[model samples]
Target: YFQSHPAIQPATVVVEDRAHPSTSELSPTWNRTDEWYNYRSNPRERVHVLAALDESSYTGGTMNGDHPIAWCQDYQGGRAFYTGLGHTKESYADPAFRGHLLGGIRYATGHTQADCRPENGYRPLFDGTAESLADWKQAGPGSFTRSDDGTLTSSGGMGMLWYPGQDLGSYSLKLDWKMASASGDDNSGVFVGFPPSDDPWSAVDNGYEIQIDATDVPEKTTGSVYGFRSADLKKRDRALNPPGEWNTYEIR
Candidate 1:
């Protein structure tokens, strides 16, 4: 389903799946030289694209307008991952490239957990823009402060910042977050499938919470469906980055 171009080319690889372990630590736009491959058909419809070539950055690309360089999927009940990187000897020597390859192997080997199903129709709920922030309202004691960079940080909270927009159903929610404290003890959570109520406890009592504290017990720790179920700790730990680094959460 693919053929390589004749010459080595330099291009920027735009990361499409920040939540995937393979591309989590990578730059949003990674510049490198490699033998770009042209697939007969776009694999995005069949796989979860991890990263792709910025065709505009290089000449002689053959994928027309879209070029996927890395992707992963479940093929006949087995995990399959592919990347068009590492085309040169120097690529293996590169630390970032090595980590990328290792992470892919880990996922394929079932050492880590990632949602590799084909993702589609996801729209931003909070895209680090003030205009986008208009859809949310803060309730309770502490309020969230929006920084110039479009990140909202909770200053104090016995309360929650919630979406006051239309009720959602059968949806997926994704967001990027990081701990501000160096201690790695700070805790927060995203409550889902909750009913509309001014009291923050309404969410706690009515919906499921995807916990965000790394140091808590399994049932209340990171990746846990708080008070309901604990994530597979081994996979959770393997997939999670250390505190202070940005982490993406995809809750469906």
Candidate 2:
């Protein structure tokens, strides 16, 4: 019935994302006694994670080392929020806890707003539209299908979508994507660090690719900087949403 199980104990809460209204008024290190619960999975990139539990501060930490205690997500029709606090009857009596609850409520109900956007630095390159693709140059075979809801899906891509307009050195790139395949296996990658070339193979030779296919070996799978560095599978697997669901990737 629950993905996270609870434990009645004390914890030192640490603010992970401080820009949010919920964590703005609270102290950076909050020491409180509450029934902390560890989720079977983490909803990191899937939500605006306001705060997290310092695993070293307590036990029953089943979420490996990374645990998200407070997070909020913008749903299809409304917003949803979850916190690993407020288990005991005396929790509501605490003024700091009450303030935290009020702040969360205000942001959820649109009574106040915060910059809930993910990936702090980086301008949008392609906004999931065919129109946005004008800024990009397609080299080689296959194409990406632009959907009405603003998602670009790979059609038959042995090709490359290259942003010829800019030469990036130190910058962050972020995009939200979902594969159509049910097996959680798809073929695509966001290529980087290469010069503008009409031939996509040049990027393959000189630049780097962040793999999207999950079926490959760890070195070449999703979150891997193809052939160069392997992602920390333990952390990557915990952070990933299932394939058919929209997932946000922040490439720095």
lDDT for each residue of candidate 1 in 169-193, tens digit (9 for 90 to 100): 8877877777767766778999988
TM-score of each: 0.72, 0.54
The 10-residue segment with the lowest total lDDT in model 2: 113-122
Candidate 2 vs. true structure, TM-score:
0.54
What is candidate 2's local distance difference test score? 0.73
Supply the global lDDT for candidate 1. Answer: 0.83
Most accurate candidate by lDDT: 1
Clashes of each: 0, 1
